[model samples]
Target: MPAEEHPMIGVLLNGRTLRGIRRGSTQHEALQLYEHAAARLGCRICYFRLRDISLRRRQVKAIIPDGPVGRYVTRMIPIPSVIHNRAIHLTRRAQARLGRLHHLRYYIYNRHTRYSKWFIHQLLSKHPDIVPHLPETRQATPTAIHQMMERYDTLIIKPSNGSIGRGIMKLFKDGGRWHLQYRTAGMERTLRTRRGKRSKRRIRTRRWAVISFRSKLPAALKRLIRQRRFLVQQHIPLACYMERPFDLRVSVQKGDSGSWQVTGIVGKAAPAKLFLTNVAQGGTVYTLEHLLAANPSLHPERVRAEVERLALLIADHLDRHLPNLADLGLDIGITQLGFPMFIECNCRDLRYSFLEGGLWEEWAAVYYQPISYGQRIWLDRQVTSGTAN
Candidate 1:
């Protein structure tokens, strides 16, 4: 088959320093995996930054790997049939540029926010099957916080647009006193003596701190609410291993069959004394088998089945409402009683978690699955335009 005849797929990234298209060092492995998949599927995969696109020319300068050395060579290629977005956040200018190319299809759509949490909650609250799996979440207000604290012993406060477990706080009532444990940004000062000269060095870090409040919310917590919108959720009592709470990260993606499937599911455990189980926040990932083996009391088969089922349900529901949603990562908390609670859904999930866990095969599947989906989209477009034989 000719190169142009093969379906073209583009991976969109965030970096803008490059003149045309180039893959960052971090994306090297992903580029190789995509190349492997393209060869197997007889498609063309290219990596392009948003700035590399020219709407007037209907072309993009895409980075194509040369050979085994993985040297990237740039070439001006026609706009791809579909784009797989890997950018963390899209700026307004980028969005406008992409909007101009309305003909190009995008697999993964927009980023999900805490407001999306409230929207999903409202949508699923009426469903008996889904409502039980969701925690009570609302826009954080003084009145809402007080009411939620009264109903549940513990409540979680999270930023509306936060990721990687940043800006999350746990508020709980301890007898007559209220306690809050949250991660805060602090600078660590280190004195160094070099070449007979002493110097002071400061490094920024996120440190966890605990505060006690009496009869009222702390002024710090109140100020945070005023600064940004937050989501207040009833904290679920999660199942633990070695006395540290853990949750399941289930990734669901659109497969070649055009259906949502659970691509990878792993247990994420936070370090001792920490509440968030995000891998970025000093958490560790464990395979399902190892996690289940550690907790013999939990039913491995049943929990796995329920997690996959709920993940698919959530994915399908969101796909129906939101167009161009190709994949999502769901943070599900399984209670000690084996009940699963919906934590949050991430649109732009990090693939490194799977890679770090040595699940390279699974990671490759996730990296290439979008390409397969894009081929299908291209075929459908051909048929719609009466060009297919």
Candidate 2:
């Protein structure tokens, strides 16, 4: 099929990503991977922002590829009915635009990427199978925090809308005193290389502080929770790798047949003594097999099978309950006894762990899955409307 004649699928991006593309920067996103994946799947992709669409005209000024070149050109095209929304727009006006698009009968998967963590926990709580895996969670009220602290020796207090392990705190009791450990916002320092080629990088050195007090919650911690919506959950004693706590980031996504699939699983080990295993927070990525091998008690085959089953079940359950969800990154923690514990769910999964873990095959497939899934939806609609090419 000719490139121009292939079915067009939309890749909705955030304003930052659109501007980055316009500025010839693809750092914030892997635009090349998306382009390559679309090409491999025999589909044409249009990259556009929500504001680029004109609802009245039903057209979008989207960026499309030029013939045999890596360059892109802007052109007007009908609003693609099949849109994969990768942006998280929190403003009401932005949300209104999304609602309007849906009203216009656009097929937008992952229409709402961000969801309240507390809300999702409640949704999963209703399910019996999931309940066993869920860590006890509650809205971050003073009473809830106090009561939960009494039940568990350690608790995690984090913002409901947080991502990449930012704004997370660890509360634990030891030696007749309670300790609060959290990362403080620190300045970024850039190091220059021996060669004169200067490059900027965020300083990996994180400043973590520990505060201690007796019995009652610290005024500082209490004030922090009051500032925004937060969730206090029981801290799962995650099984460790090299004696450092780690968690598995499972990429569950829709495949070409529009069915949920476990695309990849990678282990993220936290920095020494840190409570976070988020990649952005300097966590080291390792192959899931390697992590399981280090923890000898867990049977490799049994643990692998259990993780897959649990990931699929969660994805399927969330798909039925949530609206238009096709991709999810679940942070699943395993106990020393190999029990899978659901830590957190990320709607926008940044899939660097696969690449970092040297799983090139899975890394490539993560990029291919979304476009392939989009192609599936577009073809299904075409068949239904008798417009198949």
Candidate 2 displacement at residue 326 in angstroms: 0.7
* Candidate 2 clashing pairs, residues 3+ apart or interchain: none
lDDT of 1 by residue, 1-389 (tens): 66677777777766742322343455423556777877778877777777788877868888876666356778897767577776654467766666666544433333221235666667667667788899888899888898898888888999877778989999988877888998777868666676756566666676888999875888888899999988899999999987889898888988678788899887888899888888888898877777777778889999999889999988888777765788787889899878888898877767667776777777888777766776776667666763321
Winner by TM-score: 2
Q: After superposition, which runs of candidate 1 have C-alpha atoms over 4 Å from their true positions? A: 16-24, 27-29, 103-116, 123-128, 188-193, 196-202, 386-389
Residues 178-228, candidate 2, lDDT per residue (tens digit)?
898988877777767788566686575568999998877788878888889
lDDT of 2 at 331: 91
Supply every candidate's count of residue pairs whose N, Cα or C atoms clash at under 3 angstroms: 0, 0
Residue 307 lDDT, candidate 2, scale 0-100: 86
Model 2: residues with Cα > 4 Å off, grouped in runs: 1-5, 22-24, 187-206, 386-389
Q: What lDDT would candidate 2 get against the real structure?
A: 0.87
> Model 1: clashing residue pairs?
none
